[model samples]
Target: MVLSYEPSVKSRIMVCITPQKSSRRLVERGAQRAKETNGEFCVVYVNKNSDISQDLKENEVLLELFDMAQKLGGRVSILVGKKISKTLAEFARENNITEIIVGKSLRSALDVILHGDVVNPLKKEAMKNNIRVEVIE
Candidate 1:
């Protein structure tokens, strides 16, 4: 008996988006990397319930991200959660994401004091899952 099997291919790349200017850069870079690697591109945006003001700003950015992802032949997700970094990591693991592209935080002092920085924990979590994380400053 001869069996021909197909190799397993799970090459999905995800980008973490926020309302900062760097998000645009991150999406562009993530798309380029995905294209170069012949991988699927995805975008993840974490939404926090505490900030009503943030919601409006983030919505605008989210729309741009969606458009960007669509143009790149990819998908985008907006997750509502308290822990931004943790949520993104979980999404990556669940979606079989190989790489995560995130932009440096533009969080205000009050926001940082309230919620903490996202990039550090995100990197740690990604490392634990063996997911490559790229931080764009």
Candidate 2:
């Protein structure tokens, strides 16, 4: 119903979704946790630059995930950026998110070496903003 956007509002949980199977589980866990706390939940997808086909496929996945989130009484949002962790942190700050739910890292070795892992950075950023970050298995 009335989802308060204030930083001091009641618990607000944010679920970060990717094109991984674990994302679905993470969303479900986030929604259940939110319900347990009598709070609200939202799902977010970060899009990096990619080819048209890839983007289309990602959009399809996002739509499906959005439906899942909606069925669980959660909202969905999309954010486009070069740096996912930074974008997510900015979004969390702007939205006054109290908690963040993220799946385990799905990055390859090279990707990890090149861009680093999102989970650690997200956790650090969330800590600075006084938000809690939970990594779902």
**What TM-scores do the predictions have?**
0.80, 0.85
lDDT of 1 by residue, 66-115 (tens): 78778977677778788888888888877767899888777788998897
lDDT of each: 0.77, 0.83
Which digits, one per residue and each the tens of the lDDT, describe model 2 over residues 33-134? 888988889998887774445765746766778889999988887777788899899999988888999988867889999878888899999999999999
TM-score of 1: 0.80
lDDT of 1: 0.77
Clashes of each: 0, 0
RMSD of each: 6.5, 3.4
Worst 10 residues of 1 by lDDT: 1-10
List the candidate 1 regions with Cα displacement exceeding 4 Å.
1-8, 50-58, 108-114
